[model samples]
Target: MADLELTGAEVLGPEGLHRDGLSFRDGVIVAANGGRRVDLSGYLVLPGIVDLHGDGFERHLAPRRGAMKQLDEGLVAAEAELAANGITTAVLAQFISWEGGLRGFDFAAQVFEAIRDTAPGLVTDLRAQLRFETHLLDFYNELPALLREWHVSYVVFNDHLPHERLAAGRQPRRLVGQALKAGRSPEAHYALMQALHAQNGEVPGALKRLCMELKAAGIRMGSHDDHSAAARADWRTRGVDVAEFPETMAAAEAAHAAGDAVIMGAPNVVRGGSHNGNLSALDLISMGMCDALASDYHYPSPRRAALMLVASGVLDLPAAWRLVSAGPAAVLGLHDRGELTPGQRADLVVLDAETKRVAATFVAGRTSYLSGAIASRFIG
Candidate 1:
């Protein structure tokens, strides 16, 4: 890699933003100023985003109901989008759920394998995270082996079944659509839901055992949409430390109190509230309960959300931006690449100071996305 010194920009450092030039060589930041200088007077150079959880790549992988057959190409295209949005390290959240078709085990395996195969050639650091449905007791025994095979180190447990409705013997909303999507008849799907709900008593034991096994394997575990303190406590007891999108303030507070990493959807912050009337991420952030903001289902939201927080006076630039950068890196247990400090990976994004739009992105000192007037600055 070429040695370069980016000068004349408001470079974000470990403490805050400064006018000091940033230099990097051989894919890592350096303390010495030995590279060719590039003037970036009107830009704000910041740490590249570390996205802990996001499923926005699903559309790129399967644009129109299996429209894209080559999954590797889809991944490459997804990486382009991620780079455009200023993400350097992204965890693509793929589901292994009872829902078949796009979210089935088979589809998830394909996505994971494609990511593993395509990542080496891509500039963006792409990783796979398995969103496992907790009610899939049949797969619990083999899930650890499956995760190893898929090369997935992060796992989030979720249960989307409407247990109250099932216990009431009432059909869930959109049962027929869900059944068709799963390639099962409405009657069969309904029966399946009932059976899954009936075994709820046995789930805790199975889940605890699974969590123990996964913990022993050194895999990171998290719970999704946690709704109560008790629920958070139970997961923590099972060695699940990360809390992804807790649905209530109590749940978030519980996670915070326990020193667990609390991840909120970046879209929730950008929108000022949850789309489904759950807990407000902004509220949690204001209370200092949220540790990081993830892209969730929108790649651009992480950047927009952090900037919005600063614009709204919720936090200063460094504090708000940390939710997307260093905070997420910590959640993922990554010791490098979150800050522009020497010895760290040279992962960064340059944004037009006026519009706050991404002008360029770099990962490992390699240009991943460079456009607009910034391209000329580099070329000239």
Candidate 2:
């Protein structure tokens, strides 16, 4: 039996964009023919967007200041947004910090169980990315357990203490609390913050220990927002393989030079700036410094950013396409995805280039989303 053929779809291959047909069967692509005569003249298609860094689920987890959202329900809503944005393989960032109050390890643990149990049935293929705050030594206990989980694809080390406090004799909690606008019980928040700050305010010897342990257990390591070349060198020494959003161009250039993958936030590109005032992603792209781009917070940013890059002439469409697809997949060592070639996992997304909108999304050769009339008809 022949697989379903999508012909006349605007397909992006190694060559360039062309009218094409792709055949899907048994959850993988068997053939792709840009010259075929099937009728898909209205839609554009590309490899499914691969997001390497994103952590906004904290928004859904705590939607209304103090309100806790149900994990299963939140995940379902997140998937709809991912598919609508052309993300078929999503590495949902889950920050497992040493902090004790809401959005801390305890809360993360529950979400982990829910993610492991529910991800297989979700609309988009889901992977867990544990953003580890290296300064939090107390999280050592969780590392062994978390490394055992099958869905954990990434483990990033971020040390946020410098930004949280000026000088603290009390505990790391004193300044950290201001970042949140009163979420849970004050006492509970106080205790958790104090306990966390006490342990994480120094260089993380425990993290170095856990890194080796987790590496031995087959987990990949990443470094987040490294501010200098020396920091990148330090992460390299710790066996950290991926550099996510390095704050300086020199640091990112060093990572790329040293054979480490350099990641940037797509939002940074689309907005023409960094929310945290870090190195600009467009600047990195233009200098040939960055390797991959993720929807760090907003899911739609990756697709929109890629199109904008091509339109602005920062990169040709093919090269720009790699930032959202092949680049991140290669960075993560996920060869089975990020390409539309035969024998690869049959994940693909259809978009309307005119409107820069997702028209349809597929995962493993099956439809994950079919946009409604408004989306289908939209032309930008």
Candidate 3:
């Protein structure tokens, strides 16, 4: 709306802090220099955080354990919440699984397309991520068309078939009971998982080829929960530039060795460890091994974890900010935002620096949320 300008705040950058004024016209930053001036006396201006993976919004889409809501309103609420948390660029990690009922790709596709159409009216920019399960070949068979037209951010390869592990009495199937209750009989699920594993041998090769198709169309792709150096190397060879929640120290180091950005979830950092016994992000960051932090299931976790890292002396503020903002924007290949650089996108967060709390957020130069009005919120 306004050609926004603000001054008298600590502008975070890779090099360090600077007392500079920043100005934005339309949605692009027009200036960033100490000489420029406006009026944000006590605010701490930081690049808006970028979330690479989060399914918290899926709660709104499927609330109350089994209840469903209108996708339009649900997504709008998700946008408001994301903006409230100061996430300027959000990747909607929509699941594409073999399950063939509600919450499947067909239903998610319509809703995700609706999000793209309605993004202009929402509080933040919305990007899509096809969370492709290795066992989801049935759903994936139709992916070529969706990937072509959708603003697909990244493709995540997952293989969460605890069915085989569960049936052998090695673990419980509680994790995927929802899918099981949706008429995917345990036997059938096991059969599907077994079939998919066999099919996976063929699919990774096909998916590797599909990566070329996606790249030709400008889509980025990545692998999820890679467990070893060899696994990371394999995906790297397939043109995957991101390693999402790599499970082993060797895998994370390998991903880094191969020049793939390593992304971990903030909830993993904040909760003292990972949910799935993976490498602890705190340890990774201690070793300077982590690149970006996604909101994952808890949107506020990223924002909170960034400050917490500073508070705990794990990272000075600028470095912490990079993990959430510039780091993600760079890894995601969006050179348009994530820094207070001139000509960058004007997605920004204004914080009460003394209090270390977000005061307001602007997405594409628009006032999307006022932290003074939402400081008490615990969710995004």
Candidate 4:
């Protein structure tokens, strides 16, 4: 909580980058300039990234098949990775689905319990997000209690089954592999899929009622991979205001038209297009459709993607950086830390200006990750 002055860096300010540096104390950003100075002449200071949705932590939790028996260790590893990548606040997107393995309800219970227990010692602000598969109708009655127990504030509705193939009476190509991972035979899995698909008629009503209950509980909700304007409208009617990775331009436009935030994958922006041939994030950015960029499946991509946007002349550094920081924070209703302003939380990242690489990350005025060079400056 001691006062610290970060001098000799180009600090990102509301007006844009400033030559004068910043000062902070007591786990909050402060306006006062005089303090114990730490020179960082060749660095660029920006607000720390806030990832709204990311599943990359799944690898740490289960590196190989059934390897992660220790949830605490996996979460610690995940926190380190997030901090190293300049993330200050991260939403761990855990699935509540029938796909089983790491995505099942049982696994989610363990993760939620571990997160609640381990969060106190972590520097990074970790939060849970439930990726609720819409077809898991039976869980509808149980989800409210789970959310309450887990203290989850975010939930996203997803329908990931290959409905087209299933409706055509053709088994999906990866059925066996998926079933094996779920610890069930292909026949059993197929039967489960068929049974779920049969309830597609009842899913809409159940989802509507469930969404209303979640909204009543003050939980933020969103829909995933919306494919059309009509799909967006349907979700909007259910009070699912945020649209996560809308698959088509029409869907994104619809979300924007409704004043809902549109989230796209940071990897999509870095790769210049969706790997699955959906909408292009950069294209959406240029058109002003994408409101925020998430880490998605890769932790490093948020930083890389924002810098890439700057390099591609799509946006200036401050504007592009907002997509990863301020934008996502606002979408998730976190009014505290996304901007480099006085009285805000002192969550920030210092990057080597020449290489655009993260030199240090700070969360709530505490060092979470620091390279040797940056550490030496403070040490000496």
Candidate 5:
């Protein structure tokens, strides 16, 4: 890539925002200016967003049931959306759950393979995260091998089974639709749920063993939708140090107390609360409980959420922006590409200062996205 000196924009540095020129060459930020200068007087340049978890790519991969089969093309399209939203590094959370169809094992494997194949050609840094349903006991023994084979390093344990309904021998809500989507009869699906529920006693032991194996393999682990302090503590004990969207304040607090990274959905912050009536992400953030903000299922929410926090006085610009950038990079143990500093990867987003919309995004010093009047500055 050609070296370029970006000048006149308000650059967000590690200390704070300043009117300084930023220069990069060979995909790395540099201290000395050596390239052509691009004046960006009306823009604000900040570290590119590092989205720790998101499933919004699902719509791109499969817009509708059986709508798109070219997984590689879908991934490329997804990268465009991510770059437009100012995300440089994104973790696509694919599910390996009993809930079949797109979230099933076969589809997830295809998605992972597609990501691996397509990422090298794409500018956005796309990574895979397997969201494995904990109740899939039969699949536990094979998970470590499967993850390694798929080149997935991040795993999040999820338990979405309606245990209370199952224990009461009642059918879960939307059983018929769920079964149809899974390509199974309603009776078979219900039976499967009951069977999975029955194996609850074996789940904890299985999870412990599985966590140990994954830990040995250097895989990062997290727990999803944790509901209580005890549950969060239990997962932490099992070496799952990241908590994804803990459902209760107690769980979030427990994760924070134990020094685990707590990832809350950025959409929750933008919308002012959880859509399902769970504990509010804004509340957690205000109390210093949140470690980072993820895009979740909305690619644009991370940027919007950080700005909203600043507008509402919950945090200053730097602190709020960190939730979407440096904070997330830290959570994922990424030592690079979250800050606009010398020697860091040249990953940054330029926003219109007046409207705060993404005008351009650069990943590894290459233009991943360019739009509006800013396109002229880069091209000229």
Candidate 6:
């Protein structure tokens, strides 16, 4: 909670970018500039990136196969990565799926407990988001209570099963490998998939009931990898307003038409397209269909993609940066930290102007990550 002032930087606030000084105290931006001044004449100061959906923390949680250990340690490491990448507020997208091991309910419960315990001491404002696989009929009755117990406010529905192939009694690709990872035999895994898919008749009703319950609990819901306009519309009717990475333009258009926030991966933009041959994020942005960009699997992609957009003339600096900041913040209902405005949380990212690299990250007026010559500015 040290008072600090950043001077001579081109700061982006609610009014837009301007050369000015910013001051903060007791974790909030204030009008009165009273603090030790640090000159940053050639830097760009902007609000910290808000990532609405990121699973990059999964690598830190379980770096390799069968290496899962302490959840707190992994969470600490994840926060360091997030801060280093200029993320101030993040929603860790942990899966509560049929897939066992790290993505299953037991591991998710561990993550929930760890996050709840470790969050107060962390600089980054970390929150949990549950990615629920919709076809898990047995868990339909139990998920709402678990989500409430975990204090998770955001939930995204995903149906990752290759239902067509499974229903045909054909083995989905890499079934053995997936089963091995889940600590089960291939036969057991196939049986599980068949049993889950066989309950498809009951899934619709179960999903409707679950969504209604979650909506009543004040939990914001989203649909993932929406493949069709009809699919998006169905989720919309069930109160799943946020569309996370619609795979087709029609799906995205449906979400946009319904006034829902459409999220795409930042890495998709950085890489120029989706790795899985889905809709291109850059193309979506150009069409005015994309609302926000999440880090997805790559923690640094948000900043990289924003700059990429600016360099490519798809958007100017303010507009491009908004994809990583204000856009995601609004989607996630975090109105406090996405802008460097007075009376807001003092979460800012300072970038080296020439290199366009993150030089430092500040969260709630505290220096969370600092490096290079920028580190010399604070003479403590």
Candidate 6 ranges with C-alpha deviation above 4 Å: none
Candidate 2 lDDT, tens digit per residue, 1-380? 22456776778876788765677777778774332233557777789999987875667666766535578888887788888888988887876664444547767777777678778888587788887776666557767776576357578887765435524544444544643543545566556555556664355576667778878877888999888889899888878979999999889988989989889999999999999788999998998888899999899999989999989988998899899999999988889888787888778888775776887888886777777652433221
**Residue pairs with backbone atoms closer than 3 Å in model 1 (clashes):** none
Instruction: Point out where model 4 deviates above 4 Å.
Output: none
The CA-based lDDT of model 3 is what? 0.79
lDDT for model 1 comes to: 0.93
Which regions of candidate 1 fall more than 4 Å away from where they truly are? none
lDDT of 4: 0.93
TM-score of each: 0.98, 0.88, 0.89, 0.98, 0.99, 0.98
lDDT of 4 by residue, 1-380 (tens): 55789999999987799987789988889888477999999999999999999999989999878848889999999999999999999999999888998888899999998888888899999999999999999899989998999989899999988899889999988999999999999999998888898899999999999999999999999999999999999999999999999999999999998899999999998888999999999988999888899999999999999999999899998899999999999999999988999999999999999999999999999989899588888878
Query: Model 4 — TM-score against the truth?
Result: 0.98
Residue 239 lDDT, candidate 3, scale 0-100: 84
lDDT of 3 by residue, 1-380 (tens): 66755766777765777886778887788864333245677778899989988888887776765535467788888888898788988988887776545456666687667667777677688888888876565655567677766656578877776645645655345536844645677667556656666675577767777777777766688899988999888888778889999999999999887788999999998998999788999999989989999999999998888888988999998899899999999988888888888888889888887877778898878878875633332122
Candidate 6 lDDT by residue in tens digits, 77-116: 9999999999999999999888887878788899988888
In angstroms, give how far residue 284 of model 3 lies from its true place.
1.2
What tens-digit string does per-residue lDDT give for candidate 1 at 304-371?
Answer: 99999999999999999999999999999998978989999999999999999999999999999999
Residue 11, candidate 6: Cα error in Å is 0.8
For candidate 5, lDDT tens digit of each residue in 219-330?
9999999999999989988999999999999999999999999999999999999999998999999999898999999999999999999999999999999999999999
Between candidates 2 and 3, the TM-score winner: 3
